[model samples]
Target: MNSEHTKTALVLGALSGLRTLSATAVLSHYLRYNSNLKIKNRRLKFLNSAGFALLSKLLATGEIAIDKSPNIPDRVRPGGLSGRTLSGALVGAAIYSINKRRIWKGALIGATSALAATFLSFYTRKQITRNTRIPDQVIGTVEDVIAVGGSVAVLEGDR
Candidate 1:
């Protein structure tokens, strides 16, 4: 696989670690607008649909709002981690498929990156919150920006 494809998978996966739906939302939006793409997988065709794009964006926005709540479970929790991993895998596979490369490789890289980033980001956020005494909501907002901005950068850079 090309290094650029691998890099995109890794970055999107890491962003998924921060917000499970963010990468998929951005990717769906990208796919929706870029009509020249020729994705062969029928299952992935939904990524190009306006309805799917809208739904993913709404879900991502909801995730962002709920993420700021103290009652929300840690992202490293089994359920959260699994969702993020799946999100990473989906987007990674989509990226590779769009590039006419092997989707499995991208899925593997994306899932692994998401798994690693989940723990790393969790601890890093905890440390920053503990050390700086800043509200977690503020940190989470910053993380949202990173996830959203990073997703956009990775996908747009590929063009």
Candidate 2:
């Protein structure tokens, strides 16, 4: 693999780890309190891993697209939603974890990041596919996955 693909894979792996952990936390909370999903801890863990893998694949694809495509958005641009989502997730999670006592507070920050990420994915998708009229399949797939993940994160609420 090229350096760009390597970097993409690394970032996706990291994001996958993060997503799995966060999903575990979210699912654990639900099972502990709600008792509705009938989901076992083991199942939750599995789901977390699966969700993370899906996210990682999409993100990895997007990263590769960035290197291969001419129309990739610049990170510094005002409307660079993909960058905002990626950076926001990292910063939001970090800030939240700093004071782990108030999980709700941290969750709120995460929710905000997720919301922003959703918008970013949508914007990036539209922009990336604009000129070509026919989006690269990989790019399109990443955008879709990001959009779905972002929405799910938001719906899960301040977890």
Candidate 3:
């Protein structure tokens, strides 16, 4: 890819991940605290899983069209998985606020996660690159782990 395109991709990918992370963080927090939450734990877990699957697919599309020689087919850039973590957190927070009938708290939860996601994105990049595994495999497996683990963890919370 051309330098300009590469730069654009890097910026866009990072931003996408940051957005996703923040969203996930809010979701995770909301679910954890929401007393009036009606969604069954299994259903909530499924929703989280669906989000990851969609995110992965989105990344794969980006890789095919823009990444060209992606190190991993589903690896959505470097910080993407961490971003997913942020998203889970956001989900939790949102639920907390909704249950309490305090909408603003949910917004704050989302904002905080967005800010944190940037740091997480950098840390994730470091970890993925530092591992001696082949770039493609590492990226691919990391993506799968994040996508699967993020959702599964909520379901396993009782354990």
Better of 2 and 3 by TM-score: 3
- Model 3, span 1-159: residue lDDT tens: 133322222222233343443224333443345444333334345434446546644654454344334443232444545444444333543344334433344434443544454566546765876875657445545543453354334324422
For model 3 the TM-score comes to 0.40
Model 3 misplaced regions, further than 4 Å: 1-36, 39-93, 155-159
Across 1-159, the per-residue lDDT of candidate 1 in tens digits comes to 589988999999889999999999999998878776546577788888889999999999999999989999999989999999999898888888888888888888889889899999999999999999799899999999999999999988988
Considering lDDT, where higher is better, how would the candidates rank from best to worst? Answer: 1, 3, 2
Which prediction has the highest TM-score against the true structure?
Answer: 1
Q: Write the per-residue lDDT of candidate 2 for residues 45-147, one digit (tens) a residue.
A: 4323445446544664455445346576543355444444443343233323322323234334444544444455446656778866665566755553543
**Position 39, candidate 2: lDDT:** 28
| Ten contiguous residues minimizing lDDT sum, candidate 2 | 1-10
Ranked by TM-score, the better of candidates 1 and 2 is 1
* Strongest candidate by lDDT: 1
- Sorting all predicted structures by TM-score, with the top scorer first, yields 1, 3, 2
